[model samples]
Target: MHIKRVFDVVVVSLAAVVWLPAVAGGALLVLLTSGRPVFYRSNRLVGSGDPTKVVKFRTMVKNADRLVNRDTVPVTNTRFLNIAPDSPLYTRAGRLLERCGLTEIPQLVHVLSGKMTIVGNRPLPTNVMNALLDEYSYAGDRFLTAAGLTGPAQLVGRDALTDSERLRIEGAYCHAVLDGYRLRLDFSILLRTVLIVAHLKPSLSYTEVMDLIARNSGSRSVVALDEHASPRAADNTEVA
Candidate 1:
């Protein structure tokens, strides 16, 4: 923990050094194939006190967000689930990038710029962020630290679970950070993440995905949120 920043700089710098070519290649592919910007930036909550525009390879269409607003659904739902393999929004190259996780490669820029870390909670989409704060005041607090490209919850499941469950896992990860367990989990998280990527297969459904994550992360309470409860009181405050 004492060498946290040191570790971040050294590891990420080394990663950038080794992966520079891949990063450049990914960017060039996006530019050439999509004929648009090589990167995509969207506002997300880094933590309770930090808001940032997360940078990643532009995998979707140029105005994909405007066209589909696909970020609102839980990954298990129809918008993403029911999409045909030949959906026009995804280029042939883009589908490969998603499977290989290359689309996320540009986030290294954000990590290098100090807006994110090599490991921490993945940032939330804007609508998801608003929904989160509207339901759980303590949820946005998870973003108080630098956003992570991958973290405890991600090691558990990348695109699984409901919004409320994601919040619970995030909260648990934040608790681990506060309780000084980050160092203990850091290497394990990295190792598991590598394994997951290496074995990338079909998309896991939301429930199955979340269950795996909850189990792996050792979360004791990842219950569903109250249906009728309104968390808007938590929203008036600026998240950053």
Candidate 2:
């Protein structure tokens, strides 16, 4: 919608104006403490299309991605779910950045550039997206909207929820947008996002989340994927 786009640009531009100084300070801190490469660039697919480089403040040791074995680790609330607290992969400065979410400040550039919105589904890396598609039938529906810096899923549970629960929340969000996009709804989510960033508990409850998932699960537009299927075989399964 025109209003949504206008809202995104206006709100995000104003936010950039307010947060740019913090971004600058954060960058300088990363450089002085960690040395060079103040930002980390990642290829993320906001939708089902080609990947785009998403920038964020570097919050790990140099080449940390290359060193971590993601498949063997446990998921956590932090951005780097696989990197444990004691892991040598985290730089001293990076830990502080992660705690305060300073690492994500650079994504303001994404919001200003129209590559992302202030509120929407979180963008997924290519491999992670593909893996989700393999596991859940409704997973692809998340790509229906531009990815957000924060969203319903993030406010609802984030890394604390299981994979199935996450996909369900995302599917409900996609269904909500498809039904009718609303400025008020976006504003509500944005407010909740601010609270979450402030380290406050969200008002959303487990019952509410499950209710949304149950309501949308049987919708003709959203299909459920087999949780157990391998990537190769998942493509062949019929949508239910």
Candidate 3:
């Protein structure tokens, strides 16, 4: 894990240099296009017990949370079909950010702060985390490592995946980490992630990747965190 942390620090530092301008531009765009409070901060669980704030460019309207409740869809589900394109809760600027994937750039700060890593399990919303824990036995195992900006699941199909398929991939990743994490694996995942961002599809099917993870996972066992741990509330500040 020490090696992974060192890698994260070095990579994130370099990324900040390259992405700092983009981050600033994104922030300014959000302010002009959407209005004030250009950043949206949410509470996400990192490890089993660590709750950290994840920042993103504010893509939705200030009243979006109240206008639309994400809980309508069960947290364990991978698809968020309820949030349609025509939904009033979604802002024009937010849709563009989502399409270009610029909204997530702010999370580099979390990566630098050690609240997240360059590659690992994607962080879940507090409610989603709790729901998954209640539904799946393997949910806690994913938390054994820090949340990731990009990972196998993201490289696979992301929200296009079914709940079971998502959990399977996540379990495979957790198992791999517990058994043995290597710099090579991280580099491979990072490369694939870049391809994904560049609009290139992965050559391997999601099932193929899952099978690969299973074969490489070895026999390591991962323990889940306490189910009763309380989640922190995210502070939402609206700037006019």
Q: Name the candidate that leads on TM-score.
A: 3
Error of 1 at 113 (Å): 2.5
lDDT of each: 0.61, 0.68, 0.68
Candidate 3: count of backbone clashes, pairs at least 3 residues apart or interchain: 0
Per-residue accuracy of model 1 over 1-240 as CA lDDT, tens digit each: 345555667777877765688788887887777777778888777766545678888777787777665353453321112334467888766887876767677787777777777777887666666655654566675675667888756654634544445555566555555544435455556666767777854334434433544444433443232223322333243232
| Ten-residue stretch with the least lDDT total in model 2 | 222-231
Off by over 4 Å in 3: 70-88, 202-204, 211-240
Kindly report which residue stretches of model 1 are placed more than 4 angstroms away from their true locations once superposed: 70-87, 200-240
What is the TM-score of each predicted model, taking all chains together?
0.73, 0.79, 0.80
RMSD of each: 6.7, 6.0, 8.3
- Model 1: ten consecutive residues of lowest lDDT: 222-231
Q: How close is candidate 3 to the true structure, as a TM-score?
A: 0.80
The order of the candidates by TM-score, greatest first, is 3, 2, 1
Per-residue lDDT of model 3, residues 106-206, tens digit only: 88888888888888887776776766555556677777778888777777665455544566567667767767776766777788777777688644565
Model 2 lDDT, residue 162, Cα: 56
Per-residue alpha-carbon lDDT of candidate 2 for residues 1-240, written as tens digits (9 for 90 to 100): 566678888887777766798899888989999998999988888877899999888888888867663344333322223345556777888888777766777787888788887777887777667656655666887878788877777666564655565665676666666665667666767776677767785557534644543453334333332233333343344232
